[model samples]
Structure formats: C-alpha cells, structure tokens
Target: MSSVLGVSVGAGTVRLARPQHGGPHGFVPPYTFEVQTLAMPEQRAEEAAADAIAAMLAAAPEVGATTITFRSDPQARAIRAAMARRQLTNYQLVPEAVAAVHFAHATTDMREVSTLAVYDLGSSGLTVSVVNARTSDVYQCERISDISGDYLDSLVREQQIASGRIAHPADPAGLAALDALCRAAKEQLSNSNAVAMPSEQGLVLLTQENFEALMMLAIESSARMTRDAIIRSQHPVQAVLVLGGGARIPLIARVLERTIGVPVIVPAEPETALARGAALLARPAQVPQAPAAPTILPLDDEADVTPAWLTAPARRRPLAALTSRSGQNRREVSAAALTVSSLVVVAGIGLGLGYGPEVLERGNSTDGSQAVPATTSPRPTQAAPTSAAPTSEAVHATVAAPPVRQLDNEPTTSAPPSQGPNTFTVVPGLPPVVLPTLPPVVLPGFPPAGQ
Candidate 1:
C-alpha cells in the first residue's frame, strides 16, 4: 500500500499529517503526528494558499501520496485554482466535515451516532456543519465570519487600549506585537483563571472571568446558531464534535453543551482533528467485510473501519503527480510570498482592524450563504449585524455510500498544545519548519501561558 499524507487547508493556516499504521481499529496515539506550523497570508487569494501548501510539501519530504480537505466550496475552488497556477492537475479536495467524521468513526463511539454537528471555530471564521455520519451528506451548514478567533483577538486589543496597557503603536510591527500579546492572553484565559504577561510597555493581566465576559455575547450568539443547526439537521444528532483552534476555550464548550443539549465531544487536540482524520482517510486499508453465504458472524466494529462515502473521496482524490518531492520541484517558487515584518500572531485579524462581523457576513440563512471572492482591501468599518432567515428548507445533499460503523473505540493522539491565541498552530519557539523570511521573536519577562 502507498503511504499518504493529509493536509488541512484552513483560511489562516495549513496542517499536515501522516499516519504510520492503518486498520479497522483506525490510527491511534503515536501512529499519527500532525504538523501545523505554517501560516498562510490572507491578502492574496490563491497565491497565498499555493505558497503555503507548497511550502508544507517541501518541509515534509517523506510524503508519497497526499489528500487535502476543504469546508466550503470556495476553499475547494481556491485550492483548485492554486493548483492550476502551478499546473498541478493531480490533486483532490475533500469536505472538511467528512474528514472529521472519518476521524470520529475511528476515535469516538459510533454505536449511537447517525447524524453529527461539526462546530469549528477557527481563526478566520465559524463553520457549523450538520452532516449524516452514515452517508456523509451535508444536511445544513453555515459560516459566521464576524465571530472568529481573529475577531475575538481584536476585541481583546480594544479592551487593552481602553485599559491603558500601552499606546497603540501606529506602525505595523507595534500593532502586531500588541495583537500577539492580546491573543496570548485570550488562549491562556481558556485554560487558566488568570494570565499575566509582560509587554514592551507594561505587565498585562487578563482573568478568565474578564475574558469570558468580553466574548460571552458573541459566544452565546454562536450557541444559538448551533442549536438551530441541530434542529434544522432534521435528524437526531447523537453528538456535537467541536473542532478548531478556538474550540480550546472551555467556555465555548460549556455554552455549546448547555445550548445544544447534546453531548459535545472534543478530540485530544481539537484543532488538528480534521488533519488527523485526513491522514487516516489518506491510508489505503483492508476493510473487513461481512461474510457472504448467510454465515453467523459477530459485528466486529474494530476490524471494519470502512466509511462508504468517505473512502470514495479519499480514493478518488489520489493524484499521481502531487507527491512531496515532485510537487515542490515542479512549481513552488512561482508565487511571491510577501513575508510579514515581524513574528506577529494574526489571531486578532478580523476585528483587530477595527471592524465588525457585519463586514464579514455576506448573507446567513438556514442553510448558509454562498462564498464570494475575497477582496484585498480591509473590511469596511463596523456596522449593524445583518442576518437573513432561512428562506427554504434544508436540503440533504449526499455525496456517496456506506456509513462509518467502527467499534466504540476511544481514539488517542500525541498532539502538542500548538493552537493558542497568539499563534494559529505550533508551540511557541518550536514550530515544525520555520519560514525563512519571518523569524521568531524573543520576549523577556512574559510567561508563555498557553504553551
């Protein structure tokens, strides 16, 4: 069997994973390791994505075959467009939620789950997906741009300015540093009650209570949206699999558990769930088949880790030309990657620009709005939040075949605390492969709270 590498292309970051072993029991701890250190610049559309992915492939030379995942149609299109730029035709893009379901089948108990709600709160946006765990069909999906990790970071910056932490550095470097500090505080607040850090100006301290109060309004709104999605799924949702970097926030999980009234499950490292799933799906496995001839055979969920709809996509997406070594050699230097001036964490990007989600919200309905072309200019200043009610009933769109009926095996992973406020992925000072242009910065007194 050929080895496959899994890459999850997020708006702000890209994560890659490769599984060492595969079977019906699925991949376990130490078998799958995910690398999520590379950050994608958002100013340019396909150019940035291409560069980031190309860089990722170059960083990992052992990869043979590869599979990638996308959430929205825009991401799939963008990935294709990026491939076209490099004349890379041998590439496939699978749905992000489907990849997560594959991972869930391997890890979580699938005995009772028929439908699933995947709530991902990443750096760029909030994507809520209602999917059939059996058929891999997307029943209902929505994206909220205004309330994301970046937006929350901006809110923290606004509060910092209001509290007189330091004068707003008009230059990009200063702005980046301040935003990084704010992002660190937010991530630390998720795991601890209070976080104190030193900056160029003074010591910054943020309490969990203060942080929750700051984001409670936005979190509550998202919770309502999750509840509505579960109801709109039109099927009994057995569990809610919360994925993404922001999913680290305990408050987000608590509010979701309370609002959705369903058990919310967070993987060992919530942020890399999709990438790890992609890694497992990338593998070509020997799926145990139910014996023919009406023989009495016990249902062995462990030996049967096959997904009807998921396996097809992964198999269909295998491209001969997109291996690690050849891809980088074919076309990596084609795009110009404009490096950021400093090692600034862009967690507070959306709201940090002094704007609101109204700028990000194109149109949100029961199903969700179509993705438009991304603009290079900054989002317009804050305005009234706009929302469109669901005009039509939810359409259940199925992709392919069999349900993932894996045994109720609790999956495990040896993931590092890489998703923090100040960074998209990777522990500070320990990125998998550092970009040549943007080097690391050193802080004197500030404690790396989240890491």
Candidate 2:
C-alpha cells in the first residue's frame, strides 16, 4: 500500500496530510509560527519556507512515506538540506494553489470543467490562481504584497493614527508592542464588535466599523486582483473558489462574490483543502494521465481531464520564441535596466525638491501659529525706594559693559571701591565683535573743497 505526505506551508500554520486507506486522512496538529523574521531583507522568504517545512516534518514523523510533497516552491538546496537533515530522499515541491484542483479531481467524478480561480488569502499575502480545470493544471498565479487579513491588522493601526485614536510608540519597542496589539485586535475583531489594546498609552478601542474602514484598501485590492485573475484565466470561469485562512472572512467572500458575479464556493475546511488535495495527488489513480497524442487543452474547453480537481489549466507561457541573439542584445537589456534606474533616481530627486520646501514652509507656519512664551527677567520690576527706572541706553550700556577686577587672591583693603557708576572695563582676552564703523569723518579744516 502506497502512502503520501502533503505539506502546506502557510504564514501562520503548517498543515500536513497523510492519506491512509479507507477513511479520512490524518492531519498533523497545526503548528503556529509567526513569519515576523521572515520579513527581513535577506533569505527571509526562504527562511520562512524552511521553518514551515521543518514544522511539517516534525508533525508527522510516523507516516510511512517515500515521498514528501510541498505546496511551497522550495529551493533545491533548501529541500536537499531538509531531506539531508531528515535523512529522507523522495520529495516534490509544487504550487499550493493547485491543491483544490487535485482534491476536486480525486473525489468528484466531473471532468469537463476547464477553468477555476483559486482565491488564496494566506497569512502573508493574497494569491490568486487561474487554472485550466481540464488538465488539473495552473495557468498562472498572481500575488499582492501583504494583502492578507494580517495586513488588515496593519491598516487598523494606521487608521488609528490617522484618526488620532492612538499613537504608535517609538522604534523597536513600539513596533513590537504595536504588532502585538494589532494582532490581538485583529483576532478579537474577527469575533466581536470591538477590542482594546491596553498599554501605558491607555486602551485603544477598535470597533468593527473602524476595522472595516481601515481595511477598505486591502479588501478592494484583493477583490480587484481576484477579478483580474478570473479574467486572465481566459476561460469562462465555471466557478470562483475561495480557500485559505483569509477566505474564512465573511467580508472577503462577499466581496469576491460581488466582484466576480458568481457565488463564492466555500468548501469544507478550506484551509486544509490544499493539503488534502496534495495527498490525493499522490494516489496512483489520482495522478493525471496524459492523453495519447499529448493534446493541449483549449483555453476555452474545460474537459477530458482526470480528477475534476486536476482539470485546470497547466502553466501556460506565451508562444513567442527568441531567435539567436548577439551579445548586443544583452548589452541593450542592461542599458535599459540602467536607464530605468536613472529615471527612478531622477523622479525621487524631483519629488524631494518639489515637496521638501512645502513641507518646511508648513512646519514654519505651524511654529508661527504657536504662541511664543515671554521671558521673565530675574531683576525685580519693583523699584528700590531711592532708584529710578534705568533708561534703555543705560541698560544697554550696562549689558554691554565687560567685567573687570578679576581677583587673584582673597579680598583685601586694596580692592577697589567701585566708582564712575561701576564702569565696566574691557577684558584683555575674549572673543570680540565689531559693530559697523561710523561714516568716515569729513576731512579736517585743511582740505576744503575738492582738495
């Protein structure tokens, strides 16, 4: 009896399916891990891939298997390293989006459907697959950056700041704390009308209305991308299918339905459908058999394929062929790339120069609107009974006066009794400032006239 292992690596969970004979397949308990560090610049996506794979392997060590399949397109080195570490050999990495296609074909008897769109809103990104329903194949997959429900959490934080509802903390501490709060709020918002993030800054309350308002952009983008995927599938979509954790969001399903003009089909356990489909693909009878003539399914025709699941479009590339080219072609492509980079730099500089002044001017205006505090002089305003108010010139002269009488030793009878209204003499060594010179005096009585 042959057995197969199917692994689905998601942002928040890693699912493993082990198909056993004559019953529901056993699944590994879901492993929850944050893809936080995976967002780092270097090797981050791969690191997330590897960490997820490791979790899957750890979950199902006892499943008798010669082959391991992955929804993630793992790099050869990473897979090899994993296999080496596990001391296992047979492995295959394929698109996770193809899971439903595999599952549909295995369990259902229908084979004529030609096109299906897979809407995958995973933890990190929103992915849509346009596939040929006939071949159990994918035509294309497109992903948007951070458009998942997790991303909606970020939108919520931004809305909070924009609405003056809350203030984010500073730097690393702030980021970590905000992440925690947003995540908690997201989970709570999923279930309740409101949630609060209690911190030293006080509680930040988020209502469902606020959450949806925050997520409008992401929701709209996801819907638009889903619609475009259906359009690009180049087939009259028989159905628009929803899967992934984000699919569980009612708002997402509603948006997809409204956008695609088809009822969003929410299959049972949509999150695990992909893993189940992969395991089903491992079954001999479930594998797609090629037609005798190696016929390519027409983009319009969704038929004559094994497993209704696998009957989707295989990956298709445009048929343009490149004839032999000289090194000049390489140089041309490089030059084009360099020109694009230069244009980007110029655009950036233009933006900075054009907007930088406006920003500075606005800052100055804001400063001007604020009241300037008056400085209180330490000298008493109340006059001594015998003294008159000093004239402005006298005050200026007094302020301009330099300190004299530096004492080398303790005070003695030799110390000067200050005279001449405490005239202050200039010190010998200090930084000096010169005021503008008065106009040169008219020559003395000697050169009268032009002389």
Candidate 3:
C-alpha cells in the first residue's frame, strides 16, 4: 500500500506523520524532533530538520511520498535543497498556514463550511490564513514574527525569574532547561488553572491567569491579524481552525473566538494536524514506462484477414492482380501506355545528346523508308589524337545537324554518320533542327539585342 510522510518544520520543532492504513478518517499521531528555532543558528536549525526527516524515513521505509510544511519561502527552499541533497523524490512543499487549514478541513467539523480563518501559533510566531474551506484553498495569509508561542515562553521565563523561583538564569544549560519547563507549564495551564515545573533552583509554579497575563498582548495581536485576514479574503468565515504547538494554549483559542466572533476548532492531535494534512496531499510519483512493442504479422502468411461483414458480400481479389490486368479500364490502360511512351522518348533523347546523333540513324534507312543495319565500331585502345582545325564544310556540318528525333523505343546499336547537304553529317532518322546558340532576332527599338 502507498503511504505519504507529512513533515511540519516549525520554529521550535519538526513533526512527521504517516496515515495509518486502516485507521479512522482524520486520525493519526505524529513524531516530533525537539529543536529550538530562535536559540540555534540557521544552519543548525536546517541540520536538525534534515536529521528529523532522515530519522522518519529510516523508521517508515514504506513511505512513497513526502510533503513538507514551511512558514516562509526561504525556509521552504532550504528544506527542499536539503531533501534534494538526500536524493528524496516525490516530495512537495506547502506553507505552514495552508497545511494547517487543510488539516482543519479534514479533521475538524468545518468540512461543510465554505470559508474559514486559520490561526497557527507556532513557537516562533503566529500565522493567520483565510481559507476557502470548500476548495481547501488559502486565499490570503499573514504572519507576525514577533507575537508567538516562543514570545510567551520568554515572558513566562521572565515572570519565573522575577518571582525568584530559580537561580543561574544566565547559564546556557539552565536557560534551556527552564525554557522546556516553561513550555510544559504553559501546556499544562491550558488544561488546569495552574501547573508546576522543576527548575535548577526549585519547583516553579505557574497559574493559568498568570500565563494569560503574560501572553495576552500576543494573543490579542494574533486575533486582530486573523480578523484582518478574514476581512481581506472578502468571504464569510464560518469557523476558525487553530493548530501548532504554541496554539495548544486554551487562552489563545478563547481570545480568537471572542475577537473573531466565530467557533474555534482545535483538532484532537493539534501538533500532527499539519503533518497529517500534508500527508493527505502527498501522491506517489509516476514512473513512465516505455510503450509496448507493436504486434507484427508475416508478409508471406495467407489467410482470410478481412472482417466477416466486409467479406460477406463477395470474395475480394488481391489488389496487385486486379490492378495489373490489361483490360481493367480503358482510361487506366491509356494512362499507363502514355507514361511508358513518354519515358522511352526521354531516354532516347538523353542518349542522343551523350553519344552524338549517330545513335538515331539506326532506326531508319538511308532513304528514310526502312530500318538500316547499324554497324558498331571497335572502341579505341588509346586516346584518339585531336584533329586539326575544321574546314568550312566540317564547321557547317557541326552547326547545321538536324535536331534529334524522339524514338519510339530504345535503340540496340548506333548508326554511322553519312554526308548530307553542304557536307554536313546527318543521322537518317532525325529531322532538321535550328541551333539554340543562334543570335536572337532583334527589333528596332530593343537596344540592339545584347545591349
């Protein structure tokens, strides 16, 4: 069975999901790689993303295609280059907000809705998209990089520091651990009124109210952006679909619902929703195959190959035999005869020019009444010596020879040259002809011909 791997590369984490073969529609857990986006360099973040994808591929070797979600074009390009370097084919890149919208449409109760506002609060920032739910198309999307889940985490950390809950806040490892703890406490506050986190100094307690107070500005800004995106889409939003790790906070959803005045939906697996949607969009790459060889039949084979209906009236004769018959039609016979005669005439003319007029004399007697017995001369063994300048008679003979006549058939032998008027050599069967090189007849006003 074909399967797709959906990868969501967020600011703080990279998540992967593959749809179960026989699971219920819109249901599947995802694998996530914990990677800090703001804390790590760009190169390291990309490396983390690549490592996550590689791990997923190693775990699910059967995945046929992959779809990755990215928040920005540059991030998408970087991830795409990394995937290409890994020789991964049949992969697609989609915007994070767009993928989240697709997930909302597939899993949430917003399937029947025509338009929706999707708000994705990731670790790095918040992105709002106006989606045409009926078509699963994103019309417009807006991103605020400053107001995000990570920003809230930072605020929570500051509050913890001010409350004197921990020490060594400047230590890199301690800061990292505190951030993780803060994220956990924030997630817990979504479910309960308060939560506790173990830090370097001691256990830090965070209340839902305190968490909301710290993240209220970011939440309000995100809600405003979502409203603006929906208004810009110019489509009535029936509901709001929220996703991303940062969006798990209950306060974010409640504030958006109150601000946008629409029902807000959070999927059962909020973090994997984008990945699942991406997987849904993945398709197996089609490998082109060479066309099958054509079936050939032997030329010598003889059988009744005509269709039964076509042969029902009468037996068909061979096409070649039918056309070869002499009495097939008077027009056809006349045309064939004409063509043959014309070809013979042309061949005789060509031979007369190449070998001189002697070839035409064989067809007629000296008196032009009967055919002559044409003689063949022995070919010279050596090159014949050039003759001296021609006399007056020889000049006339060369210039006044008759035009060669067209022959009815090919000549078997050449004729001998005989003396004619003015000592000109003539072939008996040819007619008198004028020379083509003779001066053109000039008119009085034509600039004296050549001029």
- Measured by lDDT, the strongest candidate is 1
lDDT by residue (134-170, candidate 2, tens digit) is 7757777887765875676667667666666677677
What is residue 447's positional error in candidate 1, in angstroms?
99
User: Pick by TM-score: which candidate is best?
Assistant: 3
- For lDDT, candidate 1 versus 2, the one ahead is 1
| Candidate 3 C-alpha RMSD relative to the actual structure | 21.4
Per-residue lDDT tens digits for candidate 1, residues 1-451, read: 3456677877767777766643223445444574554575764544665665576557754444566888778778878888788765434677999998988887888778899999999988899999899888888888888789888888888887789866777799888788889888887776689998888866677888888899899999999988887787677787899899888888888998888888898887888888778777664434699877854556776765455567755765565445765778655543323233221334244345432242344333224543334584433432222554222221111111212222234344445445344444345556543333545565878765456
- 1-451: candidate 3 lDDT, tens digit per residue: 5556777776656666766762223345342322222234445565566766777678767667778887778887788788777776667888766677666655556646788887777776778888777766778878888787767888888888888766656678778788888888888876799898676677889997887888888788778878887888888788888887876888878898899888888876576677777766777677899999976755566765665676644554565567667466877879999999997887676565653333344332344332324374523432232656444444345434633434445565765434444343245557443333555778776787556
User: Can you tell me which runs of candidate 3 are displaced by over 4 Å?
Assistant: 22-42, 286-451
Compute the lDDT of residue 441 as modeled in candidate 2: 60
> What's model 1's TM-score?
0.58
The regions of model 2 sitting more than 4 angstroms off are 1-4, 11-13, 17-61, 66-77, 84-86, 103-114, 163-165, 197-201, 267-273, 280-451
Evaluate model 1: give its lDDT.
0.71
* Cα displacement (Å) at residue 35, model 1: 1.0
RMSD of candidates 1 onward, in order: 54.4, 38.8, 21.4
Question: Which clashing pairs does model 1 show?
Answer: 146-357, 301-407, 308-402
